[model samples]
Target: MLVPKRNWLQQAGFLTGLYGQYLKVYLKTLVEYRADTLIALVAGIVAQGSTLLFLTVIFQKIPKLADWSFYELVFLFGLAATGKSINQAFFNAPFSLTGYIRRGQMDIMMIRPVGVLLQAIGSSQELNGVGQLVTGIAIMGFAGAHLDLQWTAGTLLYVVIALLSSAVIQFAVLLTISVLTFWVQEVRSVIYPVNWLYDFTRYPLEIFHPLLRGLLTYVIPYALGSFFPAAFLLRPESYGWAMWGVPAAAVITMSLAYCLWTFGIRRYSSVAG
Candidate 1:
């Protein structure tokens, strides 16, 4: 019997449907553990709220930080927090890649017909991100009310695109680090220190030294996912490049991450082997 091959669109639809099924099961599990989910959600909010409180205290001493008003900083922090929440919600399973490799879980995923990356992503959902998502939206709304900005349809669309692209960039960077587990077997030592760099993006890039600015803009590029998007919205004349650059960076970094992921999979050897 000959089987017809599905086109890209059909393949994509299939993957999307499969992921939705994973989400449904995940939601069911969360519903069954309401108390634990609530605790996790509260913990996420408290952790993120503490950062906002710290910023509030700092702003009390000064009207502005690096020429950005407190509301402007809130917008930037909200943007970054939203992007991080999206990443944690949908793409955080790769954080356990080392454990998967050690426990021979990769073998099971490899034998499945689905893409390994998609399978890994669908294996778990970080429900705690729901709290961060809630906080980010609330913070953004609070800042938006205070900031003088035009809210045209184009601006709204651009904001959506920027936030989605920011999440893509974060996912790509984290996935790239996770892929390194194929070689190192334990990449957390590198992942944690690099992850801490995200904190720097919460503040205005102008406040940093040129070297650190360049590092964030080019080397790590977390600023593109956080600062640049908010900057573009807050000051289009000064940050016009971000309108396109953020999406471009997302595509470039994701391509590189997927290539690394593919390379890792090819070279992967099961623990039993």
Candidate 2:
């Protein structure tokens, strides 16, 4: 047992070191476009903030949306923002994979010793994700003060779990969509629906039709990624099931995404050099 444990630890450390090198290279490349990167960062912050401003305008006439007050909605939006920021910062490289495939760059990835999927994901880095992260932190802080909930050790642990799960779900979803481009070769049209997912986080699941709510919760699983986590954190007594659902749904979606990506790559038929 101890021998197996030691081997597992060694493998974990090796993988961590490999990922660290990938990250280091990305950070270096990000700084290479300092000026343009700054402009993009500012634009991303304003774009995300403007969405929240619109939400505020709509909610002014309606005090509660399915029993969710303005601050509660803010908390949900913060969770969604933080989850998206995490995806943008870490997993968004996969978003470019489709372009690489169409441009025949993916052939080079297959010859590399590193995992091809991981290599494809690490090809491009976005420094602008940092701006989204900063805004996410600000939103969470505002939600904390306005929502006003008593925190405990267990609740803190759950909050961390929720954040992690939310990130995983969003990352998996994005990856799955990107991988689809291997077959479709044109996914720009679907991007609008992807953007619309953010709307789901603004209100509680209860606000949607029962069938649509079930579809989001059980099929696409977006509810688990943001709404359920926010619901649990902001109203633990009323939504305790989310404590289990958030992490469970994330794990399920990740496993499925990994399988889909693997299958998609195996089906890949790139041209010869």
lDDT of each: 0.87, 0.77
Candidate 1, pairs of clashing residues: none
The digit string of per-residue lDDT tens for model 2 on 24-120 reads 9877766887786687678767967897797699788898877888888888887778777777777775668877887878888877655676776
Candidate 2 segments exceeding 4 Å error: 1-8, 29-32
Where is model 1 poorest over a 10-residue stretch in terms of lDDT?
1-10
Candidate 1 C-alpha lDDT tens digits along 189-226: 88878877887998899999999999988988899999
C-alpha displacement of 130 in model 2, angstroms? 2.0
Best by TM-score: 1
Badly placed stretches (over 4 Å) of model 1 are: 1-4
Q: What is the TM-score of each candidate against the true structure?
A: 0.95, 0.86
In model 2, the clashing pairs are none
